[model samples]
Target: MNNWTRKHNKFSVQNRLTPTARELWQWLLDEMPEGSNEIIDLRDFNKWVKRTRGFPHDRKTVKSAAQQLLDKGVLTQAKSYTAYVWKWRLQPIRVLMPPPFRKPQKKLTFQSEIPNLDPSNPQPLKDEYLTTTTDLEDAESGEFEQKLQACRKAGIYYYPKDAQFMHGFSLQEVLKAIIYFLFNRDGVRHPEGWFKVCLEDNWAGKEKERHQLRVQWSTEGLFEAIRYCNQKMGMA
Candidate 1:
């Protein structure tokens, strides 16, 4: 039983969402109870996607689509509701739209508003964030460097390929996550384990993002190919 309305197309146009993402948006709207303020678990949403749709979409895909929606301001994460750090998998997300009926609305408390938790979009960080874990060895004074050192000291094993994979995000973001967890900003009891999960999930999301970009790039080539074929046919 789908609760989607024709109005969903408005979201698709507004957000420029892909077909899959548009479908996922409708799915969320259908699953969410009207006038309820509960957080939705991403894992459950992922499972529903696999079962309902013929295509074999995994949880990571749902997560990226969810993040894309979040970025586009279609969805929202309740970072302040939880005592612990609010990474994607660590915490649930909620649809931002108000319920149909009049009900008591909960005030929002966001973790992104927190000091160290507030990192900018994934871009080149300023000079202060460029240092490697090795450079942090002697000084150990700066908070950013200390976090990188702590990740290494925590027995987290990162190899060359893993390092390359993480290169997509600014080193500053990684270090911030580590230190923020250490400070119990998210209130995670096992910071090390949760960080590891967040790292893997974040990397998977980045790879999916890369793949989507590549697909968009290929579309241009596809149009060029069609034009070339038509020109040759005209000549013949």
Candidate 2:
């Protein structure tokens, strides 16, 4: 067996070292050889934990902790190798003592006062006309049904309802049901009116107003409405 020395005091789970995880780390340090950059087998660490630390640890625990330490810059793995080695860059174990108490962070609150608003600023025009049209032709022609099905399997609902309708259902209830499945059932964002137009024009809407509206619908309203509708339909 390799001889090892304590680089730091044993970390405690109860005494402010309560990260719970660092306790295991302390155990690892206790078992490690001093001033040496040698590969520590996970099996050895587990055995050490079981015997000296009186803790129940398995190979998985050792592996997970080793990986976590490596990720946190506490340990470094060799290049072109699978095993991990401790980084000598870590401060000497003496710094592992309990941290000093910090004052609790203060929560901030604000009070609002009503101010008179200027109504002279003109607002942009609200255009109801769609810049692009819904591409019912391709969707209705089973153009992307496979993709739709894959999305369904992945629980990514919220495709256009026409995709379902063209598959052989006409009723509004059925339409709503499909909508529910995509938006509510799988939690996908539904295409808004602008997106519908974009899809119809193959995503070539010219008017800025039309484009802006579509963007809004696609981002804000579509997904939520789909979710709400799906919930109402008991799909979710």
Candidate 3:
């Protein structure tokens, strides 16, 4: 039998392996050669389910089990077209070994006397930068009225200076940053390609993909890129 055939047959080895092992075997076969370390497209698994007879319900169950295996260091997920794909590591699974006991590293503690600020040379408080708009209605309302009426008196107004600091980046900039980090920095091309496909597919037009991208990029991508560039070029 070929590797795929052998793999498929392994699923039907009734009494040879435990129930959990059999389930895991089937799941791994669904992913094929990509089982442990390489990424496999989830859509492929969905298609496989449709093709197979007597498939398990709660389709997410397989995914959840795969995730559990991943967490246990038994599998790794790689980025595929608009989704995380599964890959199986080729390494032999070793039985859990007892952790060796060792002395904990001593924690270093230090205390410094607080420097007294000179009254004559007192530093001025830096102005807070407005990041997000709290309320459109309050913003349209006069500042004085907002302060008086709103419980959260911290009213919104456009701060051109602060806005300039976080210059509204174009979508190209976002895509470039994602590509540079995923491909250039991390040497992981899968995520970069996935993102490109996502944009091409207009996945953002659909709420699901768009929201996921926005959240990931806004929180992790932009933050990391800004920090990296700042550190490298000494620009705050």
User: Best candidate, TM-score-wise?
Assistant: 1
lDDT for model 1 comes to 0.50
- TM-score against truth, every candidate: 0.32, 0.27, 0.25
Which candidate gets the maximum lDDT versus the true structure? 1
Q: Please, what are the lDDT tens digits per residue for candidate 2 over residues 139-215?
A: 43454465455445544444543232122222333333434344433333433322222222332323445768777
Clashes of 1: 3
Task: Evaluate residue 87 in candidate 3 and report its C-alpha lDDT on the 0 to 100 scale.
Answer: 46
What range of 10 consecutive residues in model 3 has the weakest lDDT sum? 160-169
The true-structure Cα RMSD of candidate 2 reads: 26.9
Q: Residue 105's C-alpha lDDT in candidate 3?
A: 39
Q: How would you encode candidate 1's per-residue C-alpha lDDT over 1-236 as one tens digit per residue?
A: 24543234434555666544555565666666533344666666556755643233555566566667667665554443332222222111224333335344344455556565434432323343445533653332244344445577754444322232232234576765555445543565544445644553564456568989787787779899899999999999
Q: How far out, in Å, is residue 115 in model 3?
A: 84
Model 2: ten consecutive residues of lowest lDDT: 124-133
How much is 220 displaced in model 3, in angstroms? 56
- Estimate, for each residue in 65-183, the C-alpha lDDT of model 3 and write its tens digit: 45555555445433434434544462222322223354543343544244663333323221111222224324423442322222122122223221111112233433444433333
lDDT of 3: 0.39
Error of 2 at 102 (Å): 17
Evaluation by lDDT, superior candidate among 1 and 2: 1
